[model samples]
Target: MLVHLLYASRAAHTMSGQDLVAILKQSREHNAGAGLTGLLCHSDGVFMQLLEGGRDAVNARYQRIASDPRHKDVILLSYAEIAEREFAGWTMGQVNLHRLNPGLVLKYSATSHLDPYSMSGRAMLSLFRELVSSGAIECS
Candidate 1:
């Protein structure tokens, strides 16, 4: 069965552009090899990721991410056995949430800023879909 997992985590330290690039490169390569697809959004040291793949693959990957030393406060926001993937265009697409229109963010989150901890999984997912529709995602 296929599954989709949504998660949020805080960076253990400040992140730089180079660091983000490295993470994306590694994620894209590994995910492609593992048959996973997803989108990742990072801003202000926070990371929000959506992974869709075979159940075991998704779960195993999530476990690894939750335990990875580079991440802190890793929270599994949502998970489900899905009939199909919501995001399949990129091995791991990237979104810069800070560049999003404030009004767009305000619709699903408080204060025009995304605090995944304060938002419902459904809301966060909705925002992610909107980002895709708005051409806000960057692919490498």
Candidate 2:
């Protein structure tokens, strides 16, 4: 069966642009071979990612991520069986929230800034969907 897992974590340190690029490169290459698809968002030192694939693949991937040294305070936000993939356009798409509109962020949270720890998984998923629709997602 197909499953999707959403998770959020804090970066161990400030991630530079080159670091982000390297991450995207590694994720895309690894995910494609694992038959996974997903989207990633990082802002204010937080990383939120959604992974979709077979149950085992998704679970194992999450395990690896949760144990990785680059991530700290890792938390699983959501997990569920899905008949379809919401983010299938890229092996691992990136959400460019650098230019995100404040209003869009306010619509889902108490403020204009994103704090995944303070938000519900449902709300974050909704925001992710909106990002997809608003052309805020990018792939490389």
Candidate 3:
């Protein structure tokens, strides 16, 4: 089964553009090496990432992320089995809010939307797609 996990964490220090570039550089290498796929969106001091892979691969990635010192106050927002992968095109993509239009957030987080715990693959995809096109998330 394809596993999907969404998580958030607080940045330990100010995340400058250079800092993000360095992290994305490392994440791309790691995700490619592990044969994983994901999209990460950052906003309002929170890092929200969606990872998809085999159970073991996803779990292993989570383990490593949880121990990383750069990120603290880790929180698992949601996890579940999905019929389809939402971020299949990404090896480890990142979207920072600095360049993003906050309107996307307002749209996705609309009251008519599914609750975070009950969000569907399509909903998640829409969210990621918005971030992807917003130019807010760039590759290092």
Q: Model 1 Cα displacement at 84 (Å)?
A: 0.8
Clashing pairs for predicted structure model 3, backbone only: 95-137
Q: How many clashes (backbone N, Cα, C below 3 Å) per candidate?
A: 0, 0, 1
For the record, the alpha-carbon RMSD of candidate 3 to the native fold, in angstroms, is: 4.3
How close to the true structure is residue 104 of candidate 2, measured as C-alpha lDDT? 90
Ordered by lDDT, highest first, the candidates read 2, 1, 3
For each candidate, what TM-score against the reference? 0.97, 0.97, 0.75
For model 3, the superposed segments whose C-alpha errors exceed 4 Å read: 96-99, 110-126, 132-140
What is candidate 3's local distance difference test score? 0.72
Task: Give per-residue CA lDDT, model 1, range 1-140, as digits (tens).
Answer: 99999999999999999999999999999999999999999878999999999999999999999999999999988888999988888999999665688898899987787789888888889999999999999887
Q: How close is candidate 2 to the true structure, as a TM-score?
A: 0.97
Could you report the Cα RMSD, in angstroms, for every candidate shown? Answer: 0.9, 0.9, 4.3
Off by over 4 Å in 1: none
Residue 19 C-alpha lDDT in model 3: 76
How far off is model 2, as Cα RMSD? 0.9
- Please list the C-alpha lDDT of all candidates, in the order they appear: 0.92, 0.92, 0.72
lDDT of 3 by residue, 1-140 (tens): 78888776778878886876777777778888877888876554557678888878898899888899978988777688878876777788776556656466557666542243344445655777777766655554
